[model samples]
Target: MGIAGVLEDARPAAAMVVVEFIFSALQIFIKLALDDGMDVRVLVAYRLMFGAAFLCPVAFLIERKKRPPLTVKVVTGLFLCGLFGITINQNLIVLAIKLTNSTTIVTALSNLTPQSTFIVAILSRMETLKLKKPSGRAKLTGTLVGLGGAMLLTFYKGPEMKFLRNLGHTGLSHAQGSHQQLRPPPAEGSRILGSFLAITSCFSYAIWLTIQAKVGQVYPCHYSIAAMVCLFGAVQSTLLALCLHRDTDHWRLGLNIRLYSSAYAGIVASGSAFPLMSWCLRKKGPLYVAMFGPLIIVFVAVMSSIVLDENLHIGIVLGAVLIVAGLYMVLWGKAREEDEQEADEPKAKAVGQDEELGKETTAVNGES
Candidate 1:
């Protein structure tokens, strides 16, 4: 391949890493911004609306020339993607964040997407089963390891109140009351359930990505498709938020830092990221970009610790390492497969040329 081809391949990987970092930080920001005074449902509604509003003009300006004709088929696909990807995914994710820390939520959930993508793609006939290949085995094993890590993160809570040992040395005794008020009481069972819900949300997102891959092949206009999906999501999410939060006080918008956080999530995380993700999927394939989801967990861990002043527990570190290791295993397997395929190409080409020459010679002999 030429230098340009190498750079082109690297671009999507680099873009996805940036997207992962932004997405991870967005979760931590959202968690910090959430308060008992605000309704989670209302926040979801605002995010969708603001995200759509941010993307609408850009889509119109850039995709105007290449826009696919609006048809029922395209509209239906966009609506479904919007419903699953935006509405359900964001709702469950925010609810999970409300129940748990962003580190746990992002870590467990992000790890599930690749496996879910594989499963949904296989079921939808978008991906093939290759049980015979080492790469296939590695992907399967990596997925299982990731799930195990998630389970360990969710189910196992280390010894409770252990921090009391260092209370005197750290001068935590004086700040006990304030710390208690600042930290939400931990609910192990509830948080485990929330983690499960987050995993389910990841599955829904994976299915959306797999379906969108096929849709993009047919439409080839990422901006238009993503804009329409966001618009539909904004409408649906707004109605749902209104229904869930009937009190007018909850609907009131205020000029605050939380609003700024919402704007960042809407404009940068959703609006810009969504279309870029679609374009990357079209150019690099689903597996290529989907592999970066696990990195979000690391970003969330680092940012949440810094911003929220959360402790970097041993379990969190171990879980993060396991998730990264599993993700690398899956990506390594994919790379090996690509390498093997590249090695076979020349032989396949030669075989095809030989068959074609033989066919032409046989045809001439028949004519003679």
Candidate 2:
């Protein structure tokens, strides 16, 4: 209606677009870094460490006044959040991307988060459903469609689409320290392992989302929660890196793309994106926020093709289309439900007001 109103409405859309693009770039950067022989665990460890370093100060500066006492319950939730959200989620995704060499596949499958979150909510009794209702049916249908799309992306590798052939391999490739050269794909075993990892990461992310919702309710300070999670994740990942990548060589960082990629992933992807998503979840609910998940797929698909020399297959194109469609369907259903609820509120309030007026009239007539 007004400038303020329009800007307010556009904020979430803008945030989604910005975050997704940052993530797309992060994926490409991380892949390039890994291709340069950066250890996965070390990369993730640095990412969380830098993320915490950035987030902790901001949380203290901004949410310091609003920060509540950390109870055992909140601390425990943050620990689990870090474990699932950062440790498992990041590890699986990195492995997936390494093996598959397709950020498109990774992100496309991530669109399953809404469906997984919905199921997790139901199981945890956080959400109730009436399958007989239009809203319920719509949600179920959307979930199925989204899952189907994910499956297609995971298993089916159709021929590359001809329309996009003209784009060429514009991305700088890394092969044995050679920059701007085309790199070959990994073995079939690696691909299979990466696909499995990606699928598992999706479910892990859904569980993280569910737990994040619960934690957000008890502790409304989004920045603080994100900071704490990053801290815990940093600790966990560092330990794992120490144990698994025991080489002192693995810990060393050079003035190379590895440093740049880790910095971007930490500052932009984790530091900024997590807090924004948490706030959005608090304001708009998880489904509303999750609907924007498809943007990452689109961004990654284009960026991966250009930056990583990743190809787009027919299955990927088809799966992305289905996932986007399902995203809109679920969002539409949620909007309809909200509209119906809002409509009923006015009618209920009017009835109460009319009843009160009638009672006042009766009292006046008796007094007269």
Task: Give the TM-score comparing model 2 with the true structure, all chains together.
Answer: 0.85
**How does residue 290 of candidate 2 score in lDDT?**
65
Candidate 1 clashing pairs, residues 3+ apart or interchain: none
- Estimate TM-scores for all models: 0.82, 0.85
Evaluated at residue 279, the lDDT of candidate 1 is: 71
Clashes of 2: 0
* lDDT by candidate, in order shown: 0.73, 0.81
Please give, for residues 39-99, the per-residue lDDT of candidate 1 as tens digits.
7777888887888898888889998988868777777888989998988988888888777
What local lDDT score does residue 32 receive in model 1, on the 0 to 100 scale? 55
- The positional error of residue 93 in candidate 2, measured at the CA in angstroms, is 0.8
Off by over 4 Å in 2: 1-12, 162-165, 171-183, 275-288, 339-368
